[model samples]
Target chain A: MARKLLLEHAQVPGINTYEVYRKHGGYRSVEKALKTMSPDEVVDEVKKSGLRGRGGAGFPTGMKWSFLAKPEGVPRYLVCNADESEPGTFKDRYLMEKIPHLLVEGMITSSYALGANTSYIYIRGEYSWILFILEKAIAEAYANGWLGKNIQGSGYDLDLYVNIGGGAYICGEETALIESLEGKRGNPRIKPPFPAVKGLWQCPTVVNNVETIAAVVPIVNDGGEEYAKIGIGKSTGTKLISASGNINKPGVYEIEMNISVEEFIYSDEWCGGIKNGKKLKACVPGGSSVPILPHFLVCKTANGDTRMMTYESLADGGFATGSMLGSGGFIVYDEDQCIVRNTWNFARFYAHESCGQCSPCREGTGWMEKVLHRLEHGGGKMSDIDLLVDVAKKIEGNTICPLGDAAAWPVSAAIRHFREEFEWHVNDPKAAMERNYGLVNEKVNA
Target chain B: MPKVTIDGQTIEVAEGTTILNAARQIGGELVPPAMCYYSTLKGSGGKCRTCLVRVTKGSEKDPRPMPKLVASCQTMVMDGMEVASKSDPSVVDARAAVTEFLLINHPLDCPICDQAGECHLQDLAFEHGKSNTRYEFERRTFEKIDIGPYIKLHMTRCIMCFRCVFTAQQLCPERVHGIIHRGDHAEISTFIEKSIDSEFSGNVIDVCPVGALTDRTFRFKSRVWFLNPMDAHRDCPTCSGKAVVWMYGGEIYRVTARKDKYGEVHDFICNTCRFHTKEKGSWTIEGPRDLDRHSVISQNHYEHGEKTVR
Candidate 1:
């Protein structure tokens, strides 16, 4: 069994309640961090853990925490990014819904480490029921004296609030989330004055993913070195993979980083293989933003190395034959799936979610969607496929946010790996509209 | 001052000067077309990707070439930096692609449009647009709305440059208008259909680069090419009182805020100077030489004397 850190106690009956969570060794990290360690010490421990952010970017959590500018008389903030709206990713929602107290405990420890007197959980508005669950857990924490004035009599005061967003997918971006929290439109702010220097009412702030902050609990419980020893290479510590799509047992699973991709896919303990014994056609190992990998590439790298479920291994061949472990949104596709239709669906999502700030993303995403829609529905010319690639290439790096690149990658990768399929569609529009490309029944390495 | 090289021209600018402003200072054809950046607005760049430039060498501190093309309006120039705009084939292709994107859904009703002669989109499309677009899908359309008593909004023509939203937020005290919805359907909307009846609402009409926001008062007044702009001013307590009067056959058609060589309004003129001070008797009209070089009447109708309108 993969070493589970976050979901070890996920099956505990009353884990959502503070009393039950406390009985099962909750808030121990808070006590250890507040009483025994200084803020710098806590930060140093996180740095030593080698824990990269679980958010799509994979920035170093400790380095990001250290970058918070502590100016005189300015209140710093620790904002928990609970706006998990990335397509095919629902681990944060599952964690908050099942074990709400874990997040609360993690926030407390992280806020103390960052010297934050006030904190916020900027959750997506669609998660109203999860908001209630989080709020109830927060109330329970307050009642138990884990939050509020002088927590654990350590002379540190912290106040955590749950702010509901107007439900924008762009709000998942830290700057956009801060803008939304500030009662403004969720347009991404320009960087160079990153959130560390000026954010959330122009105060020094640290915006962290919910999983990144929650991992602080384990880093504090065990030493950073101990936590670092579990995962392979730079991707240390257990990660929550939100498995979906054609997988049989589709849900969130916490796996240590050392597991091989083949075992994780075929083993009964994890995704339990493809649904209805269908062969795996492709896999988006990370979230939808990362490139999709064909069945052969997903199991092994281009150099014939067995692909491990770690950041370094997954991104071995860059965007050519490898994909990133982005937010660990593992989506599997059976042979019956249509890559063109799936690409169109993602393009539509990006076009619908763009804040219309930058032209490349705002305009390019819509163009990709229109062209893909034409191709999928049988009105496409052969030149339209090249145009889709052209438009996607134009949008890749020209936008103000990563959303532009996210909208570009899937289309580019699909064209890279499956150009023949797209050509088939354009060559015979009538038959393409009537039926999908169907399953590729070739043997595994054929 | 930091010295930067742009298209073989080396110039020293202030430490935080952007490449767009630097190129604009060099003037003539070197000026990159910027659709979203208004010199008067504090935060009005980076939205429109029309100002992309390739930096061959990053700066003195980081000599590596930047990984990607940057928005010239947003990126500040550093010492020993090498930048390329119109001269670079990649930048030209990028600008052309952006121009295509801008015109994808635009209702090309230029004949009846009030801003045809002065429209930035029209000028850019002429400069960088392809003869035909590959996009054969349905264009996005929105119903024309009278957002305010003075401004008419045709949302379909809006490229989402966000200049109007920034103008309303910065100039209007009661900012009731903003972008609503998401993605391709995203549009500028007032809160709950409320009228954008702010004191500075008419300025949005001037700041808008497209015909999305047109002056309702001057909707069918006259083509901008036929109207002569005369420098005019008034001694009003509300604004700087300096403006330009658009005249046709000795009748004052409309009054708009005066702009410097850079096309930024010299002062945020009030509703009176913008809408009410339209009479020729309200202010002194300067000679025709004071009109901007880009103004349609400046290059087209130079034969017409000031007395021709008087």
Candidate 2:
């Protein structure tokens, strides 16, 4: 029974409708923000809330908002990144589908804070049903005077539109999403002129995640200080964790960031304690891109402290013995699943989704995917393991976008924590082909 | 002017000069290699990681180093910035990795390719690449596609540098072809197979870093090592008409834009000058192109001493 902000009304029936959402105190932030507070006051309150972007990067949202350049006579934009294409991350989709008005309300308030005349929600193309839901919600808001020209007589004008993406994972990246919105190919632009300075047809722009913008509603309604008191430290406020993979209750759960990782995975209210009483082998605490943690380090840190679900606690060991709370894609792995095969699957996704702008990502992603495929399919050599690490290292810091690092991390982490598993595949090809390498008993090379 | 130190050599450049340009101003071995960055073409660079350099110190105001290696071709030179190109072992390793990535799927058909003697990729492979490749997967291949009567699009040889796309948008009036699909499957395609018939369309062949785009008229004509390149120009209404005429036995084999020491074409020649007007008597010769003594074209031809080639 933790505090739920974004998803408090998620389970309410008819929450998708404007009237139903209005009766339940929806869009209160819009009224409070536009009526009482000035635009800069809203930004100040958000900064006080200590809210961070729920996207994989975990950058501070208020800090990101402050970086938006305010050049006179030049229009600034606030784009909602509804393109939730990351694997095992479906909380945004769930939030939008269950309570679409929450996002629309967030868009209106966030846009007012940023002084944007027009805003956009660039949603994933695969979520066509949710797109329809969001579009309907936006239309409902415009009809009720919550959106568009002189909202509730505040004299602050705003118009919000929903744009659908072409179902590519790279479009989730801010610059690539901007490129796709501009009716062009989804190649990521090189940064120096970041999106905050020159974005969206050469104007200042701020792209916030769906959950990040929606959370702004609560930050506005409850006041930043009230919201800041919920979660622990800098990880203030409740976060939506999209739990999946070998969990009995594998659904999106809203938890305050103060809970321990053991409580989250084993509690009856949360994941319902890994499916069928099976032994948990590992976990990718964040999304697929973050490092994977073995069973020994999942519930506790390498320093033998209780691992909380906060950002600092999850990343306590910094990729060697710790992982990130990235996008909150808490995926659990049972003993039966093989790390090598899973790593290869993620590699294939990255290779397929890469925009092919730069050389390392364009070629190296596919190269790693092919090498991992050979290893998984019983045609690997022991030397292939080190070669994969070398290639992944080369691609980590050398691309036009983070997609290169995203593609490289899973491969490197798999081999880093589970080298014996990879070597097992290389050493015993026939046995590896027949069945997966079951759970390692004693952490052979960890 | 900004004073930026690259590889321990400090130089002052103009207000908005890039790190790559600053290094080029102090030209020598430290000037990073560029495959996609054509100086004259707007919005061309940063797509090729070949020119990546480490900024050890960001600027005089912000002394913090950049978190990652940045593309030097696009990064502006901040005052008191310290950059490491060939001087750092890490930069060298990154360049070698980039070179390897660029060559994994490249059809190593330099023996038959027409851009061999002066290819930027050839020089890069010689300098930064390993002797043998580690890629065991089947190399990507594509059928030769002729974009028009003059330019052949050899998609397999492309490194996705985007130089030709920038060239088409900037130099040519209408751009018909661009990169289609994504990732490793991406190719330079005309989509519905439309012929690029613009007057300045032939310049795409020159801006291409590899043999991806070549003069269709000169396909398989001869290896470039045998033909001596001579600087020549003609007075024409459409363009500057300054070009290099590749000649063998007193006959023009192929015509191309005259590239600078960095292999960038500043004066873009038109199709009429490049494809249609190829004769020994069409223009005044400006002597054998001052071949870099280190260039592969100058290997055997300069043995008779640079004076006999013309």
Candidate 3:
């Protein structure tokens, strides 16, 4: 079995409670980090861990931490992004719901490293029940001398609070989260004054994802080098993947990053192959935003190498044949699935979720959704296929936020990999209306 | 001051000046169209992608072409910066795409609309948009909302530029209206149907780039082309005491905030100056000067030589 860092003790009885979590060596990283290591040393250890963010962007977590500006007398903040609104991504929710103290322990260690006295967990509003679980765990941490001021005679003071977002997917963006935290609408702010420089009430802030902050516990406890030794190459340490869609086991699974994609999908230990023993058609390896790969490309790279679930391996072909390990949202599509309908569904989600700040995202997302809806329902033209590509290209890099690109990638990838399926929908309107274009036995376009 | 070259023309701009402002300062058809950016309003721009320009070379401080097209309104000009606005085909294509997005859901009721002649979206579409549209699907529509006594919101015309929302938040001491809902359905709405009854509520009508938010008093009163705008001022205790009165025939039709040559409102006039102080006895009316070159009204009327309205 893969070494499960987060969900190792998830199935233990009463693990959600503070007592059980503490009994199972939960906050040991906090003790090690606060008592033994200085803030700089903790940061250096995290840098050595090679831990990239588990969020969709996959930014280097330690590098993001070192960029936090420590102006004299200014209260720097450490915001944990628990707003797991990305489609097919529920790993953060699973971690928090099953083992809330892991996040609490990680937040304390990360806050101590960044010299942040005040920390907040910005959770999505739909996860309201999870908030109570986290709050109870935080209270337990306070009672156990982990969160309060001058803990263990360390002369370090830290306070952690939970802020519930009004359920905006854009709030997952750090600046937008900061805006929402400050009691404003969730519109993403412009860059250059990044959150590392000026954020959250004009103070320097470091916003890390729930999984990124949670990984710090293991990094500090086992030593960064030890954690780095587990996974292959730059993808060090175990990652929690929320596996769903056409899978027998549709739940969060913790796996070492060195596993091959085929092994993770077919082996009994992981996804256990497609549901009902059906043939694989396409798979969105990361999240919905990443490019959808046909079954052949999902198992192997465009370079004919066996594809691994690591960041470098998954993104080897760079949006042409390969997809990202974004938020570890591993969604599998069986032969029965329709690419046009699925792409239209994703477009609709984006059009509904867009903050309407940028014209490309606000206007273009709606246009793509309408176009895709027309194509899916037999009301499409031959020119509309290229028009979808054109619209997606226009929206890709034009908006202020990544939501534009996220809304574009799925449609472009669908058309790139499965243009024939779209043509099938357009050419035979009566047949297309009756049934989906099932899996083709032919090789991928690449 | 940092020297930047835009469209083969080089000019030095003050520190912290945006590329859009610099291009406007350089003049001669290089100025990028900005739909959401207001020089007077803070925290505008970046929402509208109409001002996107390719930065070929970064400043002396940072020598790297920006990875993608950046919003020129938000990007500060740096030393040795090279920007391609109207001269670049790619930039022009991007602006055209933005225009298409802006017009995809627009009601396009130019005939009956009060802002028909003086709309920025209309002018941008004429310059940047394709002759025909590719969007064959149903265009989005919204119910007309009377947000307040003075404002009538035809949300179908809103392109979600957020200019009015920012204007309301910044100018009104008590802000009640803001953008609500999400994506294409997102519209500027008053909280709990509360009337946008602020002292400077009518400034939203002025900041609106389209006819989404129109002054109820001036709705369908007269086309903007027929009205001759005259510089007018009043000694009101509430505001800056400056405005432009749009007069048709012998009576004043509407009064709006006076914009400078760069199309920036000199002051965000209150409702009293914008709506209540339109009477002929309120201020000293000066002879109608030629329309400021940067104003949207001027761009619409530029084809016709300056006609003396008096």
Candidate 4:
């Protein structure tokens, strides 16, 4: 069994409260950070810990913090990205609902390190219950003097507030979230004046994921080198993976990054294998946006090396046979599930959620959805298979935001790996309408 | 000043000049077609994605190439940056794809539309788009609405360029309409169907790149190709009154702001001069407006002195 850094006391009675969390050694990182370490020292420790963001992008958090432009007399900010609206990813909600103080503590320590006098936690609007839990924990922290002006007489002033989004998936993007925070429509701003330089009302800001900010507590509580020693090379420290779909025990699990993918799937401590003794067909190891890997490549790399639950191991084959460990939303598909229907469903989500700012994502996503819908139903042509690929390629790299790529990758990967399934639909639309292609090993040579 | 290269043509521009503006400096075929970017309107570009150019080398300091094609309207040029616009086959292909995306939902009703001859989208499609569309789905449509007494809102042809919204905000004291909803369902709408009554609201018709917003007084009056656009102006208390009056034989059809080659108006005309004062006696006509020989509006226009208008 691996050590649990985040969820060790998740099952403890009243761990959501400030008293029980403090008894379990919470806020010690805040004290250690504010009283003993300078802001630059704290930043140095985070940089040494090799901690990448647990967000989908997996950028190094330390480098992201260092990029916050510090012009004198101007206020800097640390924004917690609690807008966990990605499909198949609910680990942030689970962490906040289970232990809210950890995130509040992280916000304090991270705000101190960034020299931000004020901070905000932009949470998803759908998590209203979790918002209640977090607010309760934040009130408790303020009552206990862990938050607010000059915490523990350390001469550092901080104030943290929580703001909820209006239930849009694009708000999870940093600039869109900042726009929503400023009481405007959630259209993503064009880049080059990144949020690190000018964000949140033209102030320098750093937006970190919920888990990435929470991990700063552990990096400060223990030394950076000690935390770095827990996981594989470069994928240091533990991660919270929100496991769902076709699994026996579907829940969030904390795994040190050294574990193998097969062990995590079949071991009783984790997902406990596929449901109902069914054979595994495919899996989207990351969230819905990442490429879907076939069953053969799920447990081992294309070179036959055992794939581990790390950033480098999962992305070893670079979209040919490999996938990313994106947001750790491990989704498993059994033999009975249809890949074409799933791809269409995701396309519909992207089309519906597109902010309509850019042309490609605005029109191309809906066009792909209509084509995929036609292919899934009985109204598809033989030429529609290549047409889908062409449309997805056109939209991939030509948009103002990454939403275009996210909408394009699933369709491209679905046809790349599961071309046979789509061809089966096109070859015999009547049969596809009646039944699904179940667990075929080889192509039908249509 | 920053020096940049577009399609192997090198030019030095003022510091903070965008790549699209830089391409315009070396004019002719090098300037990429821009539908949403109007230099006069603030925060108008980057949504259309028609002017995307590849940066082969990022800059002198960071010589690494940008991984993806960037919207040239929003990105500023770093010194020694090399951009590939028409020179790269990928940019041409990308512009075609973007043209298709813009046309898929757009109702291509150029024959009956008032802005047909002067429409930017019509020219963009003729140059960069495929002859036939591959989209089999039903094109989206909306009802014609009268946004004001002077302007008609044809929602079906709007590409969501947001130029009109910027025009209202920057020129009008109170903007009554804006883009509402989101995604493909997004539309420029007034709250609770309120009519736009601003004094300067007629300018929205000029800023529209398509026939989405047409002049209500000039609706279905005549095709722009048949009218001769002459440079004309009048002195008014509210606005500059500098405008181009579209004239037929002894009749003034419509009056609009004098637009530059890029279809941008430097001085905005008020509603009184645009709609109410369309008469030959009210203004001094300053010859025929110079039209680009390549434009559809200049098809039968005698550039010498409107000799054919008997």
Each model's fnat? Answer: 0.80, 0.92, 0.89, 0.79
Query: lDDT of each prediction vs. the true structure?
Result: 0.88, 0.91, 0.89, 0.90
Give the 10-residue window scoring lowest on summed lDDT in candidate 1 chain A. Answer: A437-446
Docking quality level of the chain pair in candidate 2: high
Question: In candidate 3 chain A, what residue range of length 10 has the lowest lDDT sum?
Answer: A437-446
Per-candidate DockQ versus the true complex?
A: 0.71, 0.88, 0.81, 0.81
Residue-wise C-alpha lDDT for candidate 1, range B116-135, written one tens digit per residue? 88888877887788888877
- Candidate 1, which segments miss by more than 4 Å at Cα? A433-446, B289-310
Q: Which pairs, if any, clash in model 2? A: none
Q: Report the lDDT tens digits of candidate 3 across residue range B133-158.
A: 88776778878888778899898998
Per-residue CA lDDT of candidate 2, range B12-97, in tens?
99999999999999998899999889899999999889999999999999999998999999999999999999999999999999
- The digit string of per-residue lDDT tens for model 4 on B101-161 reads 9999988888899989899998788779888989999988888898868889999999999
The B-chain TM-score of model 3 reads 0.93
TM-score of chain A of 1: 0.97
Local accuracy of candidate 3 as per-residue lDDT tens digits, A279-384: 9999998888999999889999998999998999999889888889998999999988888999999999899899988888988998998888998988899999
CA displacement after TM-score superposition, residue A81 of candidate 1 (Å): 0.8
Q: Give the per-residue lDDT of model 4 (tens digit) for A138-234.
A: 8999899888887888878888899988899999999999999999899999997999999999999999999999999999999788889988999
For candidate 1, what is the TM-score? 0.95
* Model 2 global lDDT (CA atoms, 0 to 1): 0.91
Residue A247, candidate 1: C-alpha displacement in angstroms:
2.2
Query: Per-residue lDDT tens digits of candidate 2, residues A1-446?
Result: 88789998888889899999999999899999999999999999899999999998989888999999999999999999999988889999999999999999999999999999999999999998998899899989989999888999999899899999889999999999999999998878889699999999999999999999999999999999998998888999999999999988999999999999999999999999889899999999888999899999999999999999999999998988999999999999998788899999999999999998999999999999999999999999999999999999999989988999989988899899999999999998767766665424324455
Off by over 4 Å in 2: A437-446, B299-310
Candidate 4's displacement at residue A73, Å, is: 1.4
